[model samples]
Target: MAKVNGKYETIFIVNPNLGEEAIAAIVEKFKTLIEKNGTVESVDDWGKRRMAYEINDLREGYYTLIQFESAPTFPAELDRIYKITDGVMRSIIISRD
Candidate 1:
């Protein structure tokens, strides 16, 4: 498939400490927000797994994969929001092209 020049794919890792419902809610919120302004190719949850290293003292986390279409400039804003989110251990957004 042809991806727009400004489009991107974002994959963020959420903390595993959140209950199942909370995890679901967070993922759904992301799906809703991303789909509202752009296109979402997929949203995948890899479940809990051990991390390579500790993050905020966390050794494991709920691994989630998200593939969405977005503008070039949108990632920074998204990153900023994710950085402040409590249950988000770490998040990174990369261009899918």
Candidate 2:
């Protein structure tokens, strides 16, 4: 099937142990990754917060939300990158349109 552009939001949690510079680099990396294939509408940095439960032995995480518009095919690549990146603890991408 042919792909169509759509609105999507991605929320990712990064390991809180990373330093400030490392955290910023991760955010910037994903921002540019999306901007390369889509138009980014907004980026909301939730900063570090206590998680309801521990993940990988960590009780806190840095949360970030990105809302963007991209082709249907693009999120798969985004997900792939997220998985391979070392400090990302979890992530989810949802279609908003």
Q: On residues 44-67, what C-alpha lDDT tens digit does candidate 2 reach at each position? A: 999999999999999999999999
lDDT of 1 by residue, 1-97 (tens): 7654356667777877888999888878777877776778888888888999999898988877878777666677778878887788778888867
Candidate 1 ranges with C-alpha deviation above 4 Å: 1-5
TM-score of 2: 0.95
Instruction: Return the clash pairs for model 2, or none.
Output: none
Which lDDT values do the candidates have, in the order given?
0.79, 0.96
Residue 81's C-alpha lDDT in candidate 2?
97
TM values, all candidates: 0.85, 0.95
Which candidate number would show the highest lDDT if scored against the true structure?
2
Model 1 gets an lDDT of 0.79
* Range of the 10 consecutive residues with the lowest summed lDDT in candidate 1: 1-10
